[model samples]
Target: MTFTSHARVDTDRPARYLKQLCSHFDRKANSTFDEEKGRTDFEFGVCEFLVEQGALVLDLTAGDLDQLDKLEFVVGDHLERFGKKDGLAVNWKRD
Candidate 1:
């Protein structure tokens, strides 16, 4: 079965982060993104990003719980690092 999780990260520059993440991941994974939305396909899972008014929405899917956990950590860790200046954090809810 597929596992999924969602995270809404509040940030002033959602578009900037989205673009940065997509660009960075593109080097290693299949990533496609614009200013408003992005998607990255990893070997274990997929992550979809959306830039909202004041937040970045992430929808992640994986083949299993282990993959889902890894996806969360990988995406959240990178995003937090990129937004470290703003004290960004990602709190995900499983679905």
Candidate 2:
């Protein structure tokens, strides 16, 4: 099965949050940050902003599916819904 991920960009501190989230994927998510998009500042800013929002980075990857054997918590719920920008998205509903 092919896996697709939908994430919310912090636009302020992305790297830090990205790292925090990737930890679930073994503390080192397989994804790489692309600098060609001129997102160096935006990346870091988003990461920092996440800290303010009380959101923890999961850092999950497709491979983690095989090793951890843990499900139901890989991807986050707060992903923005595609095909309908109605401003109504499904958040994972933290307990």
Candidate 3:
């Protein structure tokens, strides 16, 4: 099974930062973050774009993606304040 999550990008830096966080999660979870999974799935590539665009910055980690409980709310609040995204997405799948 595969799960998907969404994150609204407000700025470039924050989005790129979040992308990096996602890349780290992909490495940790041993999963591939396909473009279909998200519009931005690259690390340095996305970061470069964000940097060129001048984004504020927001790093969305895998842990903040836990939707089992109130993790979303907790993480959302922090990201909302830290990053330029309105909200975040947490995708998960069962094997």
Q: For this target, which candidate reaches the highest TM-score against the unseen true structure?
A: 1
Q: Which 10-residue window of candidate 3 scores lowest in summed lDDT?
A: 43-52
Off by over 4 Å in 2: 27-73, 77-95
Clashing pairs in 3: 6-89, 13-55, 14-57, 14-58
Candidate 1 CA-lDDT value: 0.97
Q: Which ten residues in a row have the lowest lDDT in candidate 2?
A: 38-47
TM-score of model 3 vs. true structure: 0.29
Cand. 2 Cα-lDDT: 0.29
Give the candidate order by descending TM-score.
Answer: 1, 3, 2
Per-model TM against the reference: 0.98, 0.28, 0.29
What lDDT does candidate 3 reach at residue 16? 50
- Cα shift from native, residue 41, model 1 (Å): 0.2
Better of 2 and 3 by TM-score: 3
Q: What tens-digit string does per-residue lDDT give for candidate 2 at 1-95?
A: 32222233333444444443334333332333332111111111111112324232222223333322222233333223221243323232211
Give a tens-digit lDDT track for model 3, residues 1-95: 22233334444345454455446545534323332233223222221112224333222333222432233343345445554353433232221
Query: In angstroms, how far off is 85's CA in candidate 3?
Result: 13
